[model samples]
Target: MSVADAVAPPRIRCLAVDDEPLALGMVCAFIEQTPFLELVGQHDSAVAALQAVHAQPAIELLFLDIKMPGLSGLELARVLQNGPRVIFTTAFNHYALEGYKVDALDYLLKPFGYEEFLRAALKARAYFALLAGGAAPAPVPPAAPEEDHIYLKVEYQLVRVTLADIVYVEGLKDYVKVHLASAARPLLVLTSLRRLGEKLPSRHFLRIHRSYIVGLGHVQAVARGTVQLRGQTLPVSEGYREAFDQFFNRWK
Candidate 1:
């Protein structure tokens, strides 16, 4: 393998186990996109994956699915001795936290987006590197002020906007539109308001409505349930108004 291939995060010599052929293809495609990963082989059955891993000790990673015909992914993982690092791919959210018992690097939910997959891959890379004499990755730095930001890749452009700059965010089904300061148009993203909410400073951003988050710093006006910011009127919903009130009162 070339130097580039040797060092790419995905090139860790992978074996993917999934009963669904389409799922297997999608995982393989993702692995192909990364320079560091290589598909040593794939298996539709957990038993087959187990046999291959035992036969081929050099396979360093397993992207095994949790729900499979015959032996379950967890059962297969348990039977193997001196097995490769595992990254469980599953649809069940309940199984996510439980995967750590078998020493899984990460647990990926089914129908995962590229970004979500990348996040899990990040965990796997750090775990492998640390095992190979690399120091443990540093704890995430505390988010302060403008530290909470998102990179919007749109139309071949990357726009960096802090959570503080947002006047409000409106969710449109699977997408969200962020109204920020000094932007002519809202920063549209293929994400949820809930996801963006996690990246924001809780003290500053309030989910006054199911689809809206008004930045505390940008609250231009408030009268009853109505919130006015940047000449835009937002609502403090019945369910969330108390949350806003508690936060707003504490800030005062």
Candidate 2:
């Protein structure tokens, strides 16, 4: 390798794939923060990721989630050969050994901080760096445990809705209506918005009003103390305005 080649930072073409929208958003955000990692695409499913991988041959790194509805990350890893090096991003701790069995570069537990994520990313960078330098790949470290999802009780049954699926929740006196993706109507549950908001991940959901709590991922537009969702606009109460503004400023 020449002097320029040794110093030149190789852009790691990356792709993020997770069934949870909020989770995928976080991974993409982390990738964008890394100077050497170039985000090529993001997908909500392993099937979609497979399609993207086939379409883009240059993608060299994958941040993949496990336990999706269909075509889990492990299955996708099995199907692809000579494909991008994968770093399994999952909520479950039990899958760590399974991930390494497939020769994954790393395992990223859910709700990982930037420091943890950056550590894994750098390992991938080092792996590629070694390959570029004509050396054997380095060993990847085991992942630490992190919180990931929440369960909600709706109607007469328990509903397991990932924090990512919740768009916005509306409180009507004693009941809170959860507006989630793929649901034709909101899931009305007997709970206060404040109570439900407390259960959700604070980084992803914000209580803008006494009656409404909006998921930051689903927020499309914000103007004049109001936030726009898919079809509804919710006001930001004076009590929460400052916090909402802070989140908006950082998000934008």
Candidate 3:
């Protein structure tokens, strides 16, 4: 082998497919900009992309759009099955849950910048790397019994809060108010509710609405459309009702 060939780093071969020319071009551009991703083909139709993937078994990743003419990206993905890893790109947020059901590596919402695209690409790279090493990707672990606290930023200082002491969290636009069982006033922190929810242990916390996340341990009652925690009633919106019911039923 040549010295250059021996020294060159490996890259993940990728394909970009979207019904729109502009969206396809943007995906291709992002792929080209990434050092570890090598774009092999860019197609404006799922049929063409399907052909390309079949012809080239070396392609390890696909940047696919979910909604396409004739053959949709979701249909193509189902056909491909275990053929190649996929990172779905689309404008609609409602497709996210379905995309995950099909084992998509990541979902990039439309008008996403390079940062979001790169984040998804890197996830694919890591999955490939794990496969190359002959090891299965690790599953997310459940919350440990010993892990019972988290630190939150309040104004200029970080205050440590015991996990069991939290009653609920209220989201206010860009900030969240953390209500504690022992405190008279909730602590206001400058962070999104979604972001903060990710930090809390999933076993203890559940998001019931876009504006609220409640501690399961602190919940006193559950009604038709609301959750009661420490005498405070919080509505469980339609979007989260199914998930909340599933979990609630499991404990009964």
Q: Pick the candidate with the highest TM-score.
A: 2
Q: What is candidate 3's lDDT per residue for 86-203, written digit by digit as tens? A: 8999766679898998999999866455776877877786687677774433443432334557999999999999777889999998789999988999999999999999998776
Each model's lDDT comes to 0.74, 0.83, 0.82
Clashing pairs in 3: none
In candidate 3, what residue range of length 10 has the lowest lDDT sum? 136-145
Candidate 2 lDDT over residue span 76-173, tens digit each: 98887578999999866689998988999989766556778888988998889888885433555655744455677877889877766678999998
Which residue segments of model 3 deviate by more than 4 Å? 1-9, 134-252
lDDT of 3: 0.82
TM-score for predicted model 2 compared with the true structure: 0.59
Question: What alpha-carbon RMSD in Å does predicted model 3 have with respect to the real structure?
Answer: 16.0
Q: Per-prediction TM-score, please?
A: 0.51, 0.59, 0.51
The CA root-mean-square deviation of candidate 1, after full C-alpha superposition on the true structure, stands at 17.1
Return the lDDT, model 3, position 21: 57
Evaluated at residue 87, the lDDT of candidate 3 is 92
Error of 3 at 220 (Å): 52
